[model samples]
Target: MMRIFLMATLGTLTAFAPPAHAQQAGETRLVVRPSPAVPATPTPDQQAAVLERFARARDNLVALREGRRSVSDLSPQELQDVLDYDRRVRGDYPDTRGAKQQCIDDEFRRAGGRPSALARQVIALKCRN
Candidate 1:
């Protein structure tokens, strides 16, 4: 008896309820699918291309640091507005290749030939290779 009452009440409530806009007007709602959160991995060829580009950028950085090359010599097509990128890279790594080696040697001497965790992290950040 209770089950029947519940069923009847449910039916009455549903019957009296106003129809949803789409259902009432017989209109179809368009749904737009969202893009994937994670981007697709690069192909081998794409990876190689990126590596080569970075290698070129590294060479450019070295040349610019040593005063052997000018910003105008950088290929705009290969690295767009490369001067800014070079500046940022230089800012992050203030030391040149020789300076970095000297820094590492000094750090080792300062640590008394036993590098601590902080020293290791410093070396890693200051030295590229």
Candidate 2:
């Protein structure tokens, strides 16, 4: 009777142990789907549109960083402008990489102040509020 009880307890404990295939220390299981084919190339009009969009997104980011606009304060036009800018910049603006960050730094410098902890806090609060 004692041996039977010990065997049953060990069996139950082993049964509840995590499965070996569940996950491994350095292995990640990712589901991959085939991405749709991209167009051969963007046309001239598409290029121009992309440039314009980048400029607009840069402007929006600047405004947001400088406390000129809030997340909730954007109008439909502003939202569309920012979205268009994002798509264009991501698709086009290789020359103006980090343009928004540069603009923010330039504006901060031009305003006769450096970006401080307080300024970042203010921007964060303004963005959230």
Candidate 3:
């Protein structure tokens, strides 16, 4: 038992340690372990607040995207496709980080334009937590 405890302790320590590597010029790294999350159920008020904020952010993002898209450029079907995708994402992944936003931004660039407002909101939503 004592031997097993020591091995486990050593293994955990190593897991928390930085890599042993030669530093490059101006190389820097920061490592942090966040506190373990306590999954407490949200109160009614808390849930309401979260929903309100999410709605505001989502509306703002969609509005920005609509503002940027000229009605003539994107066909009605394409516009509906984008909006439906947006809705599905929101419903399917309410707590999800904006992992798809990078793809969105990349496509936006390939098509030639700045990051859309919706893209920015995606990043912002992830940061809110």
Candidate 4:
């Protein structure tokens, strides 16, 4: 048990330590570099498609909140598309953060504190973007 404990401790230390070569070179820190390749701009058609998906997802969320639809009625692809688009846009447009957060808050309230799985799904689709 003592040997095992020592081995585990040594392994943990080894896993976290910087590369041996870096240590030898007198470097104690790691440098992180951002990606060099910029993401490709979306074409007009692609942008339109994303907007359409967002609209559909929002409509579905509203229907769900109103009890006019069920979770099964929600489109996973539509939710994912809007979320992915939002992820990209939020990074580029910091000004949108406030609007997006407000949307999320409204949706959460509309979900009635997520009393049901369907309510949770509605909030995710409506405001997770």
Best by TM-score: 1
Model 4, position 118, has a per-residue lDDT of: 78
Q: After the best TM-score superposition of candidate 2, give how far the Cα of residue 41 lies from its true spot, in angstroms.
A: 2.0
- Per-residue lDDT over 3-114 for candidate 1, one digit per residue giving the tens place of the 0 to 100 score: 9999999999989887766366667778899977897799999999987877777777778879999877767764553554576776864555586788788878877988
Question: Across residues 1-129, which tens digit of lDDT does each residue of candidate 4 receive?
Answer: 999999999999999998768767565677899879987899999999978877776676567668998766557875565455555656754354576678877777766755477776766677655
- Candidate 3, residues 8-103, lDDT tens digits: the string is 999999888867573356777688989999999999999998677566545644765779545466556555555656777768544443646665
Clashes of each: 0, 1, 0, 0
Q: How close is candidate 1 to the true structure, as a TM-score?
A: 0.38
lDDT of each: 0.76, 0.73, 0.65, 0.72
Index of the highest-lDDT prediction: 1
In candidate 3, position 71 carries an lDDT of 43
Instruction: Provide the RMSD of all predictions against the true structure, rounded to 1 decimal.
Output: 12.7, 14.8, 20.5, 19.1
Where model 4 places Cα greater than 4 Å from the true spot, the runs are 1-37, 79-129
The better candidate by TM-score, 1 or 3, is 1
Model 3 lDDT on a 0 to 1 scale: 0.65
TM-score leaderboard ranking: 1, 4, 2, 3
Identify the superior model by lDDT, candidate 1 or candidate 3. 1
**In model 1, how large is the Cα lDDT of residue 10?**
97
